[model samples]
Target: MAWKVLIVDDEPGIREVLKDYIEMNFEHTKIETAENADTALKKVTEDQYHIILLDIVMPGLDAFEFLRRVKDLNSLIQVIMITGNSTMERVLESIEAGADDYLLKPFSTKEIEEILKCSFARIERWRNAFRNSF
Candidate 1:
């Protein structure tokens, strides 16, 4: 099955750019974008995503708070925090809030591709183990 990925960013340019890159590079993935946290939450509630690429600073709800709220909503959903301002505090907060991974803004597409590859591999392993047990 194609992996479902949600890209949450307040900036339309960033969202579009990331969506295009993911779609072009990751053939086996479905990409969804949410401009704000509220819409992202609504999407999360309605569908199951394999991974979430969340912007740290947003208008309605910051990524940390959103991560806290959604962490328990879907146990299989892994989050990768994305931020332009990569502060030590923000990194620590994301880790403490249960972020599965993080990417600094202005990152290269190759970097993101690598991160997704690792994340998907881990997800596949978990799914395989679960299926085997059942």
Candidate 2:
């Protein structure tokens, strides 16, 4: 299946690295980038994304807030929070705010691949369930 993914982060380098790695390793995946929460929100409304890689330190609207908004917009969309800080409180907060998963900053390509694999599996299951319901 072709997957649509959005990478939202304030740092251009993080966005580029993620985009590059995913593009290089994953086939038939469409990836987009947003530099801030506002732009990310606009894109989320405009497009259908199976997975979103969102940063927790965005400049405006806050990352947790953004995650909640994204969940409101599409409960089926899986959001994986990206953070430089790995505090337990923040991780718990993200999960409580409706994030599907999270990745620490400076993550390896292997980690990204693993998380994406899990997200894709869950997405597939959701799609199948929706189809069966119809």
Candidate 3:
């Protein structure tokens, strides 16, 4: 299966590294980038992504608020919130904002692999349910 992914962050280097790492490690996956929450919102609305790596800090639009708005735009996408800060407050906030998972900025490769595995498994389950229903 070809999985579609989106990486949203204000830092170019973060986006580049994430894109490279995910691409190199994951097969049959296409990844897109958005520099800001505004662009992320637009992309999420116009496209379908199985997983979204979203930053907690962004200029112009607050990431938390963006996550909140995302619920209305599309709830099916598995959004994994990424942040430099690993405070319990932020984790709670991310959960409240509907993030499927939360990862620190310097997360290990294994962590991402696990996140992807779980997210894809969820997609597979949904697909199986739909196919069985029909």
Candidate 4:
């Protein structure tokens, strides 16, 4: 299956790392990057994305707010929040606010692969169910 992914982070390094890693590991994947929430939001509106890797802290708009807005645009888009500042409260809040998954910074590529596996499974399931429903 082909996947459309958006990587949203304020840092250039994080964006490049994720884009490169996903490109290297995942076949038939198209990835885009945005350095800030505003640009991310604009991109989201312009295209359909299957997955979003978002940073918690960004200038202009908060991550939670961006999540909310993105969810509003496409509830099916799987959003995974990535942050260096991990907290129980933030995790709970992110989940409650409709994040599909969470990951901490300094994470291994293996960890990202796991999350992507789960996300792909979930998306495939949803697609199947939708097809069956029709």
State every prediction's TM-score relative to the real structure.
Answer: 0.95, 0.97, 0.92, 0.98
Indicate whether candidate 1 or candidate 2 has the larger TM-score: 2
- Shift in Å, residue 64, candidate 2: 0.9
Q: Between candidates 2 and 3, name the one with more favorable TM-score.
A: 2
Ranking by lDDT: 4, 2, 1, 3
lDDT of each candidate versus the true structure: 0.90, 0.94, 0.89, 0.94
Our model 2 lands, by Cα RMSD against the true structure, at: 0.8
Better of 1 and 3 by lDDT: 1
Q: What is the C-alpha RMSD of each candidate to the true structure, in Å?
A: 1.0, 0.8, 1.3, 0.7
lDDT of 1 by residue, 1-134 (tens): 88899999999998999899999988888999999889999999998899999999999987788898889897668899999998899899999999999999899998898989999998999999999999
Ranking by TM-score: 4, 2, 1, 3
Return whichever of 3 and 4 wins on lDDT.
4
Model 2: lDDT to the true structure? 0.94
- On TM-score, the leading prediction is 4
Write the residue-wise lDDT of candidate 2 on 35-131 in tens digits: 9999999999898999999999878889888889899989989999999989999999999999999999889988999999999999999889999
Q: Quote model 1's TM-score.
A: 0.95
In Å, residue 63's CA in model 4 sits off its true spot by 0.7
TM-score of 2: 0.97
Give the per-residue Cα lDDT of candidate 4 at 94: 97
Superposed Cα deviation of residue 22, candidate 1 (Å): 0.8
Instruction: For residues 23-103, write the lDDT of model 4, one tens digit per residue.
Output: 999999999999989999999999999999999988888899999999999899999999999999999999988999999
Worst 10 residues of 2 by lDDT: 57-66
1 against 2, candidate with superior lDDT: 2
| Reference-based lDDT, residue 110, model 3 | 88
The true-versus-predicted C-alpha distance at residue 100 of model 1, in Å, is: 0.7
